[model samples]
Target chain A: MDMSQYYGLFISEAREHVRKIGESAVQLEADPTDRPTIDALFRSAHSLKGMAASMSFTAIADLAHKMEDLMARIRNGLPVDSSLFDLLLAGADRIGAMIDDLESGGSGRGDSAALIARMLAYSPGEQPAPPDREVVETSPPSLVPPGEPVGTTAGEEWGVPKTVRVKTDTLDSFVTTTGELITVKHRLALLAGSCREGGLHEALRDLGRHLRALHDQVMAVRLLPLSAIAERLPRMVRDLSRQLGKEVSFTMQGVDMELDRSILDLLGEPLVHILRNCIDHGIEPPPARGAAGKPAVGRLSLSVARRKDQVEIEIADDGRGMDPGAICAAAVARGVISGEKAAGLTSHEKLMLVCQPGFSTAPAVTDVSGRGVGMDVVKHTLQSLGGSLAIRSEPGRGSTFLLKVPVTIAIINVLLVVVGGMTVAVPLTAVIRTLEIRRDERGNVDGEEIFFLDGEELPLLTLGGLLNIPGGDGPGDTLAVFVAEIGGRRVGIQVDRLLGHQEVFVKPLGRPLSALPGLNGAAILGDGQIVFILDIVHAG
Target chain B: MMFRLRERRFALEVDAVAEISELLPEYPIPGAPPFLRGVVNMHGRVAAVLDLGAFLGLGTAGRGGSLVLLESPGCSLALLVEHLERMITSDDVGATRRGESRLLPVELVLADGMAGLLDVAALMDAVEKSA
Candidate 1:
């Protein structure tokens, strides 16, 4: 069949159906008696068969035909087993490879006869093998992966951009260019301000409006709902926990929270690391849980919430919580810290030690996950995103890793501060409150500055002192204190001058430069003055 | 396209050149190595301005001058130059191959002096290695 024109439609729709079956299979495994999910899985398999038949992709159609038959019986209340999941997953993998082969201009064919026979062998109340599989069928796939719809053709009918398949790099460039334009607008604003020409001022104002709108649209394009990166967690948790011989009930909140695609992509690894750690180190085995008078099934939950422009992600595992005393001892033995220093360390600081690059108490997952790395990578990744990660654990309870991250990395609203003759941009969203501190409000604790903010005493650091930049209009009796949240703690950053706020585009500090401790990148002011954007997440 | 850093001259293909702007106010990044001369806002985009002299071990000589913005698919850098000397077509610049190296080692022989032409890909590798 000459089906050249329909390849794109067929490939996309077929892949969606393939995904539907895999995800539904996991759901059905979780609740074997879920009638709707079973029906949906069968429908997806059937849709795949019909689509493949229409494209004359006999190999795909044949495998789907058997899968559909198997699911249909399972839908009819037959007992399902893990072996069934294994077989279905294997079938889905093979079908995926076949479609990929076809997309790359090869015949959409694979040896599915073995797979077909295996499904037939496992089928309960086996009906006689049908003589003829349906062919030349073009009805759209009836089922979509849960939370998304792809049943009818009506979505394509609308003129609006239903779904755009833009390469990430394309969106990146668009964002970059928009950032450049915003910088230009700043320059124009400066020009207008200096000249004080009425016409130019109005023109500049109009330009600012346009640029702001453009920036919003560009940023919106970059923001992807968390579900894009999170959809497979349930399946992963189920598979990994089962493989580890542990019982876990995984739950997620705010799955629809959105973040920049770039940030979200980098986030996946850190999350995977934490989740694996939860199963291997944090979560107690079923016997241990029962011994502790706890539920046999371990509970691991992820909650994501947007706090202004920043998103906070919390991964909590109700398993074996960390022992701070043991951590301190380990740190001391590893020469990570002195015995005296370890004794002085706060509970939070001791927990943070687990994320120190070479710090690990639990043996690495050298077998299944093949990940020998620890929480340090997670901390580093968060730092790079102008974010911070903190861990909270109770000895007999569990551990929760909190990550506070900026929602968008491309553009930011910052409170620019000048310290030691250098201008630095602090993300405004990170700033909880800015205050004018009177001399009475400032005090010293352990020779370090402290401030009473909102009825709480918090440690304060001079921006200049932190950067080791000398000779800033040194701290005055009355100071401007910026309270920023980092790593689940509050810090007061006292700066020499408050340069007010701005919405600026940020670029990567790039490679070696990016390695610099607390600076994310640079932002240009209206007068073309470059200011380093501070990584308050790390600094605080 | 050609520009000079201190007394040394470097040449990049015209297409590699994104824009040229007079020195912008640079905020010194405290912990960065000497080769990286902080960052400058090129329009709204923040870019790391490289002191080629420092990278080549020539020592960071000039700070106030022009920036030659260069970008590839995944990388972008602002080459800090002492001056925007002049633009010469690839044909006009007498090029030479350093026979020993597989990578391009073209030197553009200008009227007054010779400017070493760099392979953008290799330069990117150098930057990545620098990280």
Candidate 2:
């Protein structure tokens, strides 16, 4: 019987098995006696071998068969060692390549002879010494973070799946349709306001509530777990530490946390860059760590927390923290800034200088971080997605990189403000507070306007001036303003008037519009007017 | 398609014409170049409107004209033409003349006179570079 129809299914299922084997191998390396992970690794390999055999892909079957044998040996009282993980990972990677070849219309054939031989000859005799007590003490608590325990299948009954696989394009169109529906609903609400019929008003209110519920359900379907892109990060950390002669105890806390798939898609590269930076420059060699009276194994962690409409991802490492003075000096030397300019910057701003292009503190270029190209790309990527990146570090306590991003970019709540007779929007996430400050409350110091809020002095800037428009002339008894952080400084932006807030569907700018700076996206108002969303953080 | 931005006439290939419709309400794009008239909500998609008169240094395009939306992928841009003269096939024009500027290099010979064949791709590129 022809099996061409099953090729897509076989490839997808085979890919899943390969991913599971890789993930379980990494977990087993961290804890050798993890029975569930061992069982998972063995089962995935066994299933892969069965599928490859049925499909007549002998090269893949041969490699998986060897890996299954090795897992069985460990299950049958054979000692666990470092060689076992290397062999299993190599087998999974080889099978993965074969699967890729198959997807490209090849016969799924590859040269796996050396890998198969390694798996066949694997043993504990030549294994290095077992993990020392110090290393074991520093290991992560468990795969699951506290307060969220992993569920077990032992006590649960088997039932039908509660989910189904829908094409990503279909899901995207659902969001678009839902967003348009919301827009139409708004149009209806606007039209209904002119009529004084009580029944029409009541029905419009009900439609609004129903649309909100629909939006929630659609957004939930679009969310993908952070683990979708974070699965292979552990293996990467392992390989890099081994190459750099360093020992790192890496733990990830919120892999199960869900975020929009669009954000997740762009997130993988930045996460990889950050992890590489942590291993290459942030963490020190074991010997250097020992000399500094720190633990021989450095600690690195990635944690995620969801704020109202945003998510914050924190990547921290316990290694040599950056020296703000050194960074400022380097900036001066690199001509990225002047000596006088560097002297006036705060420590936080000094650290941010690392994100400037062509700024590299690394003494020698290596294959790892690629000459300080990591942080800037991270900052740029987050900014393009309407996000921000912040850094904090001490002299010795290590450094943390904080990344905050919106949960989804499709629809958002925006504060509508009239700037120069033209209505514009500021993302609610970017606004700290809105105030009607009295003219007497403002102070002019050194030719710059300043205002005090909560005892913190913030510079006052006109929104119209920033956008190169007109009408910031109202310095009357009171001024309308909104506070936002721009270039690491809190500034009160003066606008013509505050027109309240509304939820609108965001549409990405294309071509000439996309090339324009200082705008995040465009949205249509309920009255059929288009408003440009201001990227307040990055706007000039 | 032949269109007039101001007194000057320009022509784009019919294959690249997505839609020709009456001008819609437009919102100003902050910090954008002067040639970029603004953005308009075309159906549900937002498209940038380029004033050809302003871009070519002719003059600001007069309002209340038609918008010629281009069918280019990844670019939702419309040209604010004062009037869409009519659709003309390539057979009706002679093109072997390359002008100084690549944007309007090819010219079409109509019954009245010669009209420049606008290179939509080059125009988009120029907009990107300047914007």
Candidate 3:
């Protein structure tokens, strides 16, 4: 058998085993007596060693064998020490580097001899003293079920091959072809309306139904669980907490929630950035937290919720929270915003000031966040994906970073509104609700036109004026507007007319047009007219 | 390849030419610079059409023109020219005794007259910076 043909599979599986070993090590560190986690860590190391031996990669196999031997010792009633977990993590990292080398077409050769020697010489009875910090009463929950582990699904044993991998480009093309079919179906429906003869309308309706089914199936195939991107997060948080010398308990909910694979691909880095911010800037040291009459250990959590077509991911931390006044002062001192302008900003807006480019409230720059450029990139990335970031904090309480993103980026529902004869689309995620308010119902608040919706006053601004387009004068009776949230406030965007709603395939803008701000993408309508999808949060 | 954009001729490398087609109906882009002639649905992909004359600070390339689509996979962009003159071999280009112009990349002394060879990549960089 030509083992060369199986190199890709070997590298991929070996990586999964390595990741599992690291995650299990972290879990075992949190609960030293957890029998299932200890067994899991042992199994992962054993599996990795077997895989490496089959591939004849001596360096990797040697390192994995040592890790397996250590895990065996721990499984056979040897006491678990903190340094043992570090040794395990070190072994995982060394194997990870070797796998990376192999993936890059180099020999999986690395100098793990020192690490192996350390693992071999390790004695579980020689326990080191725990760090001088107040240990919390509660331990963080296990990231995944011990029986299933992080990388494996039920019935997906090694060499069993219950599922096959499909290339991402093939999936992408399927979406593109399906989207084109939907557009053609709409065009046919338009033509069918004119011909009352035969069953053209009925046949077109059936075609539309079948096309909708195909579109739904394609989108469903593109959906992947959030756990796919979140595989390394638990280990990452654990390592960073130890590095920063902070006793923090981190937990996550809704990791199994599914989202578009494309969205998940871009979302991982932003999620990492937010988590880094939480550990670095949001959480305080044990001494400071104790001095503030809080628990010695800080609590950090990420909770995800799906609402309609959008997903809200909230990352929260219980520590010495943000002070809006201090952030405002920092923005003024950095010349990011004028002092006069900062005074008029709401507390929520002041919290958002941390996302401004070149803005950092950290007293001194650290290696972890450096100059604090991550938040700005995180904000820009979310906005580019037609999502928004919001911050809520109290001076002494915790702070929460809310990220709102669409479920999928390929095809989405949009409310078509005509602005200045030309039509534009507002992604349904951004639209709160569409309304028609009579002229008499309008109110003037602080010399600005406002509309009352559900007893809440929202400022009304014309879409034409916002886009600098002309000829969007209303009928002088009722104003057609849709409520959208911008900067944590609801505003009524007035357009010429409402063209109802439709599901359109989104195409990314190319070149100079892509460089333009406030536009998310372009979509072609049934009439072959191109309309720009408004990034409503950034448009104004 | 040489093309005319408002009487003044501009030359682009033959290898850079993906396609040459008559004008397609364009839709206006909101919040875009004026020089952007808007976008067109090229096949199934959307391509931004730039009025080369206006972008070069001459004037609008105006109503009727041919689109010179660039062969850049990353950017589906096209340039509007009034008329295409002719395609010249690389030998002709190399044999030309012309000096590089400070305004554009280089000035190619063609059989008709002196035409500035448009560097699409550099032009794209400049456009991105300004836009």
Candidate 4:
């Protein structure tokens, strides 16, 4: 038999077995005396051992065989203890490692001799279990006659099923083809601009619309529901709760919200960090919670909702809320902020201080939350993804961190503007409002341009002046002032003209252009011209 | 050192070259020091670009040929230069003794015995008042 034919089957079977083992082990740990879960775990191990032996995978077969013996002993009413649980957990870890090795094209070799010896010691009186009980139990004298090599049809029933897996190169090729299609559309638009026939131009416009819709649909296929991420959290919470000796009931909603897979991947760590903070810091101890007239088991809720073009996720914990006064004091002591400034801050501002790097109000270092690198990292991670993290808390009530993320990563709607001779693109989401310069406007006081908007003075900047572009009317000409908020401060930008908005595919400006502070990436416009995209946050 | 005031050009050391781009004009911001050329949109974002010529005593060069974006760790601004000349590679664009010009400080003295190379970075630092 061709070994390649069985590879997929082997992998699928192995993964299913491992997943079952992991789930059941977690369940068994939760309720150590649960006979049903233990029996399920034993059956999974027994099946895996049979499958491995039939496939001639010696190491895996040996490990599964040993695990099966241990399970059998436990099932037979042997006293179970924490040490046995630890050994079982160790076995599970080893099995996971072996699976990883196999997936990576290794032979799955591992040193499980000691583990097998330990298992054998527990079942000293019994003969080693037969490799196949099904065949031995009812010697059904059928077609292939008991001892013959029934390799043809009989093996198919036990074989793993195959699934289609496309190489990344194929995906890349598809992307390149779509990009070319977009470029072709741009060329057509440019050419159509010269034609005067209204009917032909309208037809071309319709074609462009259809093509764009098709492109969007193609991209949407790559988007997966956030449930892919939400599904794993329940198990994670379950395991962490057991380890921390706390009762945490985690609830999730909006798991079906769809987002680009890339964004989902990047979001995992930050989400994990937030969840850990909730379990480790936010949730109060059982005794403390009971004394406070609350349920002994703390509740952690994670939810996702689509807001316009953005996704808002909230992770809330009914734990001891953050104390603003304590945070302010810590900030002052750490020299992050002066005592005067800390005192002057509002409660909201004080709560935000907890997200500052190296800021922690925990009394001492613990395995949980005291390392001081939690919330700040979460904020930075979200910011890097062009998202924002906001925290709202009330003392003794609870805490909630709201994360706002864009729905898609590919195309962004940007406001085009002319700075000197260069055309730049600014994401429309970042722009607050655009103002027109008037004759009576105060151009510059001591060489600084200040303009009034809504009866309040706002500083105005020129596109030419900021980028060192010459040939500007010295802030006197009719200017288009663009207001943008950066680092919690509102800044106004004056441009020579405000071009309309455009949907542009952002392409990263390689290492050569990364050093520029304000420029994030660049995109080729409909006219095949390169326009630089700005990073508003990095501008300041 | 080389500097541009309006249409006039002066020579500086070549070490001063920081960056060159178009200028970003800013509205007069209240309470801000002079020479802070408001703010400008660089690429897709807004940045604070300074006017090197106005900050330095070189007089308001106005908008000249091209904007020279310059920055040190503490100071950054855009200066209007007439136009960037051809790259001159010579063994010696000789150094000059320190001078007392308001715009050209003692540290910005150019090489005297030879045609001075453009010192875009130092001139920007001298003109920058923020740092």
Candidate 5:
């Protein structure tokens, strides 16, 4: 049977179960005798095995089979031990790695004999021979245990929107339809103009209102709680804390806040990178924490909240904060910044220097965190999604990485610009300010068009000249200058007119078109007009 | 299957045509290649409206009266042409083996004119490279 079609469902569900199992395993370590946690862990592992077996991914199924057996022994009053903890975690890690392999089109298999043997070693004696590794066959196999019923029990939470698993394609198509409806709404708004008051006008106005809400509902259908990813983090921090010999506890608040799954998925690597760095570098060792007059247990908090059109995720640590002097010194040594400039940097500026590519204060490179390429990647990832990263630190306290991400990618606020009678959409997030250019303010100095703005001169290029549209004279009598900050560099775009600002739907310029430079994607205006949104960072 | 760029005529395989429509309002994109004139709204979708003449290095004297929309898997763009010509039957066409642009080989689709058949798939690659 062709299992390719089922791969997407299998992978997503398997990953969820893996993350859930990891969280349960971490909890089991804290309280080995917690029956509920043990039961949950066993149930999750068994489900994973069944799912894997159904997919014919033997290695993952086999490992999960062993893990289920191990958890069963623990449930049967076996002596609680730390070795079991390591075995269960190792099993999880192997399965996790295999899933990663399979996701990139490899068989979800790995050499798990050693891990299986170790887990089997933890099983208590006096047990009957384990059931034959049954390759699961599903006519309609139940995910829950045989005796468990379908309905939610009394303890389960309620009042939340009931959600069902949908193929991503279905959701994408729904979003696309809603986007088209948005354009139609704009078209109707323009049509509703001529006749000020009539049944048709009122009807169109009502339709517009309802369509706006409908668009929101459709977009919200793709949103997932930030906790889906955040919940997986306690396990990561637990493992990292152990590896580093640091007594740390990860506490999260506002886990119920949600965002588009697309953003959350893209956020995975950068979040993990930051969280790992926090444990491996930011948090101090237990003895050091005690010596420094702080609690032996380190605390890292990840909080998410909605702020206007953006969602702010703050990852904070209570370990030894960043040392500005050390950072400045590192920046100097790496030639990222001059020693004199480093000396003049504020504490915040010095802390931010770590985000500069090639600037790292890590004593040496290690497998876990501190590999030199750190904040720069984090900053770049966030920036690509119309997001920004900010760092705050106190030398003796701790550091916090603040990630501000747009709420939705469907609609973006933009500044509409008219260049030689052609309109272009510029994301407002990247736009610093727009100024009118007078003849005296801009001139050619050393063969470069320079716009003198606020005591500093910046290289300026006409928007028309950039596109080779055949307009815009060198020394302008009057012009509109759009100063946008891209990757921390200022770029002045000279255009003929400013067509005001708007919130517009930006479409992804799939493969062929996206590869073309300067254009991020395209957007449809209120008047059935299409404009290209500048990928400002890539424009120059 | 028939299109015009200035006075020159071209033929597109019937399969290459997605839709033919009057020229829609287009917004110019700065920093794009010369032939990528601008973008236009196609129904509710945004399509790159390019001057096929300029793209093929044949000047159109800078005019666009109609658009011939084309689509390939994962990509869609429009050829901004002067206007659409009357449909041509295959029986009225004369096939020539004479050399054509390697990127987009053409078959003379008309017996009495220089109108040549356009290979859209190959032209997509050509446009991608130029873009």
Candidate 6:
């Protein structure tokens, strides 16, 4: 096989491994006694070194090899103090930089002779005194037994040998075909209206079934188990903990849950930001944890699970939870939120205030946290991917961030409506409910138009008025109202008529019509007529 | 080389020509520049679509019938155009010295024609700043 074809894959995989090493190194520094974490870091380095060597990425190869040797010594019972962990972390950073250079088609070069010499100096010549017996007794059961052979020695018995390799172009083609299919389906739907016969109905039904099947198959092909991404995270936590002089134990579950590839890429950065925030702010120091009746080392866990058509990822920590009052004060001090509003907010709302841009509760900026860039970017990124982020916190019990994202972006279930003679589609997931109202029943409450539904008055806005479309009827004898929620606010949209539900491929509206507020994109329906899709948040 | 802004005509650099298509009205995005119509789907990717008439101080009072897609550093965008006149390459096209032409907030002049070159980078910066 031509090695050139593998360069992209190699670079991506190497970067992942380096990140894992950073995380694992952090965890090892936290405990300095978790042999399993140490072994994991060593394995990551070893694999990365081998891959880099094969790919002829000399800088990455050499640095990973040196780091692996150092880890080998530590794994052989040699005590690694904070300084040694720092050196390992520095090596991890170098590997990361080299990977970045490779990504940009630059030769990785720098002065690293001194660091390489330092790594070489650490030798596993003799084992140090065994860990105290009491420490061993209390260690987690998963840690390697004191005298177990390292590396391949303990894996043959239970290891599964399976590897399936598929060309990247194949996946790319699959995505493209799926996109085209959506367009064709929309065109067919438009044509169905022009045909008037039982034969036309039968043909339309057949086409619908075929399109639905194809849509599901395409989505499945794009879905990958979450473990492929989560596997490298533990290593990352370990390395980051070591570098920052903090102890953090990172764990993950629900690795079998699957998600769209695009979603995984969208999720990567926000998850990193959240993890860094946890280490920098959530995890308390050893002395602090001990004083608070918690373990000396802080614990962080990330779990992913499927809920209906969406995936839920939870990142939780067992450190000192956030104090909403402190956050509110910080927000006011930073001038991010007004003092008047801060005073009136509930605790849950206060906690969410941390996600506001430039709002940091930290007393002062540090190397890791308090840089004025908080969870706001995370929220924006998630929202752009059609997702939401929620925060839950208790005064002293750490914070948990839950991110909900859809499985795929290619095909969506939408509620079709008519405004100003043009067809529009709204993602069904974003719609709260739909109602019919009469003009006489539309009442003004608190200076806003409201409609009573289920004993509650819902605020309403005319879709035509919102989109600047003319010729819309007033809330008269019959009004169709579509209620949608975005960013925690619910708003009712009054449309001329409800066109029912559809599963359509949403094609982005071309350049000329891009500026219409609340319109995300357009789709060609079965009859070849283009229908605009609404951006719920912006519309609200 | 011919440029159409609302009803007025101006010359544009033929080399600057990329691709032109029909305009599709896009949703208004908060914090975007007044000139930015909104993002439009170009192929499968979302591309910011700019209103050339509004961008060049030529009042965006008339409906734009065409779109011109231009390339940027990391991405490309489409600009609404009313009419794309004949392309002209001429060595004698005179240069309007700095300060010779009124400095509109978002227009740049070139030799082939006075067609307003869409300043996408500036527009993006303005958007970011407002954001």
lDDT of 6 by residue, B1-131 (tens): 56576876554444444566676646444324677666555555556666666765777836646776655444346667777776555444444333323322323344433544334456444433433
Q: What is the lDDT of candidate 5?
A: 0.77
Name the runs in model 4 displaced over 4 angstroms.
A1-56, A61-92, A103-106, A111-163, A197-203, A338-346, A369-373, A418-422, A429-496, A512-520, A535-539, B1-131
Model 5 TM-score, 2 decimals: 0.69
Q: Give the TM-score of each candidate.
A: 0.82, 0.90, 0.92, 0.62, 0.69, 0.76
Q: Is candidate 1 or candidate 4 better by DockQ?
A: 1
* For model 2 chain A, the run of ten residues with the poorest summed lDDT: A133-142
Q: Which candidate gets the maximum DockQ versus the true structure?
A: 2
Ten consecutive residues with minimal summed lDDT in candidate 3 chain A? Answer: A133-142
Q: What is the TM-score of chain A in candidate 2?
A: 0.90
Interface RMSD of each: 2.9, 1.0, 1.2, 11.8, 2.3, 7.2
* Model 1 agreement with the true structure over A294-322: per-residue lDDT tens digits: 89999999999988778999999999999
lDDT of 4: 0.66
Clashing pairs in 1: none
lDDT of 6 at A190: 66
lDDT of 1 by residue, B1-131 (tens): 77777677777887877788888766677556667776776765567778877777667856577888786654557888787767787667565645223223776665677877767777667765674
Arrange candidates by TM-score, descending. 3, 2, 1, 6, 5, 4
DockQ of each two-chain model: 0.40, 0.77, 0.76, 0.04, 0.37, 0.21
lDDT tens readout by residue for model 4, A1-540: 555566666666676676677667766776889998888877777766766666667788778867777787788786666556556666767877887888788987799888766555543344444444311211111222212222232235533435445544565455545655665677677888988989978888897798688768766766779876666576677667777888998888997999866678789878887887888888888998998888989999999999766799999999898988888988999988998888778886788898887887767877756664577887766665567777888777789988877776556778988766567788887788876767568557777778887787676766565555553554555767788865454667877678888777765433213344466556666665667676655454
**Candidate 2 lDDT tens digits, A1-540:** 687866877787788889888889999999999998988987787777777777778888777877877787788777888888888888888899999999999989999887766666666886343223111111111222111212223675545556555779999998888888888988898888889999999998899899999999999999999998889889889989999999999999988888899999998888888888888988999888888999999999999999888888999999898999999998899999999989989999899998887888888889999664568888888887899888898877789988888989888899999988899999998998999999889899999999999999999999998888886656568999999988667899999899998888888888878777788888888888999998888777
Kindly provide the TM-score of model 4 when superposed on the true structure, using C-alpha atoms: 0.62
Sorted into a CAPRI-style docking class, model 4 comes out as incorrect
Looking at model 5, residue A175 earns an lDDT score of 78
> Every model's Cα RMSD, please?
5.1, 6.3, 5.6, 11.0, 7.6, 7.3
Candidate 6 lDDT by residue in tens digits, A1-540: 356666777776767677777767767766899988898888877777777766666777777777776777777676777667667778888888877887787876666787877666643344333323112211111222211222343445633435445665687577667766766766665667667777877877787688678778877877888776776677667657878788887888897888888778778778878898899889988888888999978989999888767789999998889888888888898898899988988787788887887776776788765663468888776766667788888766898999888877657888988877666788887788887887887889878898777787777788776666653774558888888764455777888889899877765443333433455555655554556677665563
| TM accuracy, model 3 | 0.92
- Cα miss at B34, model 2 (Å)? 0.8
lDDT of 6 at A254: 92
